[model samples]
Target: MIVARPVWAGSLSFGLVSLPVGLYTATDSHTIHFHQLQRGTSDRIRNRRVNERTGDEVELDDIVKGYDTGDEYVLVEPKELDEIAPGRSRSLEIAGFVDLSEVDLIFLDKIYYLGPRGAEYGKVYSLLEQALEKSGKAGIATFVMRQHEYLVAVKAENGLPTCHTLHWADEIRDPKKEIGDLPGKAKASDKELKMAEQLIEALSMEWNPEEFHDTFQERVVALIEAKRAGKTVEKAEPAAKATGAVDLMEALRASVERARSPKVTGGKAAGPGVIAEKKPGAKKRIRSTPPTDGNGG
Candidate 1:
């Protein structure tokens, strides 16, 4: 495998021991991308950063970060933000260790592969990876990168130490507030519950990332290939029929039967039970961690 350039060069320090390391991105996107074009024309659509009031294109150097105060924009210079940014200590200072399970999935963000900075550091690198693996714990550390500091968990994955940036407590939003009209207690019939349990048991299987894939992305690529060949592209398949709430038991029965069927079952694989049915003309959402959103996909 080709090694990638490290995104950040740093050292992981715990107690008095320090291990020089490099943080490299661990994932890549496979989504099909397209350029915008003017309808009915070959002209490509282009976006420009222009002043709304002046209707003039704004240059990158003239742009300043701004915060809205409801009344007006509070213009802030990039240097001002950098001045308050985390120091360039280049050290991932481990504050403590915690059971990996204790850290909620919601808090886990982007992942990066941690590699030894040099040949001499291999022993120490392996030492920490082995320790964390044996103890079943993740070392909690804070590291600064890209003008900001991140709270991260370092743990062993596939014999390699990986660093996972975690969201601060305040950054996590409460689901209760985000989701409204909570459903009250509604008891299901014993038969219904048993059928559901049986359905789950029939569908349960070990995770095999290979078994699942981005079907939508594959479809997009196929479409692009057909267009490039000057051939007509087929229409997308219709979405699964929407069942009403009253059909819950009926749907459950059908699902259970499907899971138990030899033709469909072929032994459970992994990931989602059913692939997502995308609506025609609807936006395609890719599983990617863009820097803006923070929590890495």
Candidate 2:
């Protein structure tokens, strides 16, 4: 088996205990990138760093970051930023542990796999992982990587620990301020709501990421292959037109029936978790379990 390379190496500390660890990227992109070229020509296009005023090419070592202060640009050296970092570059210090459920999903960013740096540190790593799994808590920590400070939560996942970078609290925008036309607590008729709930119940299924694949990417690859062989390719069907408000109730009823049909679900009907007929004055218990992983971060 091929071993993965660690992107960042550091020591994780909790109180007086410290364990050497490394952070390995846990995800990869399947995007097909293309090179820039002149239109209708095979000539490649390239970008270069240059002095804007002189219109001359500049070497990478000569480039320095500049911050504009309205009147003038304040140039700063790369080393100056590193000197002012809050803590040791190789140290990841845990501030405290909090219940995993308490972490707001909005604050999460990228995830990395945290592993012991060497076989000697495996015991320490396993101890932390098991403790976190049993307690159902995540350790909140701060560390510096590549001259940038990161706020991260270390949590246990499938016998390993994963480090999830978190965004600063102030970084999240206020949705009410950002979205002007949000309908706050808009009331719907009980009949329409009940029908909608039944539709949701009919469509509900257990989460299994393995069941899904990127069909669009596959289609793109097919298009490339077809073009290479000088063959025509069929286009995908257009998206279904949305139902109007006048047909909303009819749409919901039809959706519930369609979801319950065996032909629509590969010969198996919707599971027994579906909600029953609405009873008068009964409480509505909608499923509120948000997905654990997504691109929101």
Candidate 2 has its poorest 10 consecutive residues by lDDT at 267-276
Q: What is the TM-score of each candidate against the true structure?
A: 0.80, 0.85
In model 2, the runs with Cα more than 4 Å from the true position are 263-297
Tens-digit lDDT track of model 1 for 1-297? 987899998789889999989999999989777777544344567999999999999999999888999999999887876667445547898999999889999998899999999999889999999999999999998877876789999999999899999999999998789889767678888988999999999999999999898877776665455434433333443459988769989999999999988854232111211122333443442221112221111
- Model-by-model lDDT, in order? 0.78, 0.80
Cα-based RMSD of the predictions, in order?
A: 9.8, 15.6
Residues 101-187, candidate 2: write the lDDT tens digits: 999999999999998988988888999999999999999998888888889999999899999999988889999999999989977
Give me the runs in candidate 1 sitting further than 4 Å from their true place: 1-3, 67-76, 85-89, 265-297
Candidate maximizing TM-score = 2
